[model samples]
Target: MPGSEAIRELVAACVGKVGGPLVALRKIVSAHGHIDDEHVGIVADVFNLSLADVRGIVSFYSDFRTTPRGRRHIRICQAEACQAVGSRRLTREVAEALGVELGATSEDLGVSLEAVYCLGLCASGPCATVDERVVVRVTREELLR
Candidate 1:
């Protein structure tokens, strides 16, 4: 959401002089919570990348977001192991409880739900990561907590 000059300065600060588009994008996302269209332009100009290039990289990565995210981010594992443990049901129930579908943020900005393929905790599946902390064997009650 920063202006061109501000974004340039921010990227420059992070990269010193020659900034990488991917790295600058990460910086913007970390600082601003998401990258808007304006940010994509700034990143493209500053990194000598095309707008399409920036958009492609952003969309390809699960970590990047085109819009603002909620204060708390929730990622549920949907891998085979997690699915075997009822992650699909868990995802639906959590979505219903939060009133937001997968890959959506609540209107109140409390939480954003995303489906992740794996968390490496498959053995303890139905795993979830809340605000970046992995929670194993997650349940609806645990999500509400």
Candidate 2:
């Protein structure tokens, strides 16, 4: 979590900018890892939006998390291109190997498994990312390691 002062500064910096609320929220998530209730309130207040409006934005975007993710985040591409190339099977295998379901963090908090739409590597379908590093034609073995 960032200090209140830092959060305030982040929100203040986006004031009056186009899409300031979304930008501020992204900055908060980038700096603090997640958007908590307090952060929601601060962003709403800073942007003059209703609390519901702010919360709606957070919930609508899969990129925004209300809680912290694990130390290692693994995102498997599930776009039609990837799915056509066996991303579903790959997803299942990775989840089974990691003992964590998609959109969930492991009990030990060491890894979080998530599904994303695409990685812009459609030619190399069934791609995934480990800690933000793209892996084309990723295997369960590679993800587990």
**Top-TM-score structure, candidate number:** 2
Off by over 4 Å in 2: none
* Candidate 1 lDDT over residue span 50-81, tens digit each: 89998998899988888668888888998999
For candidate 1, the TM-score is 0.90
TM-score of 2: 0.94
lDDT of 2 at 39: 93
Report the lDDT tens digits of candidate 2 across residue range 81-121. Answer: 99999999999988988889999998788999999998999
How many angstroms is residue 122 displaced in model 1 relative to the true structure, after the best TM-score fit?
A: 1.3
**For every candidate structure, what is the RMSD over all alpha carbons to the true structure, in angstroms?**
2.0, 1.1
lDDT at 61, model 2: 97
Per-prediction count of colliding residue pairs? 0, 0
Worst 10 residues of 1 by lDDT: 11-20
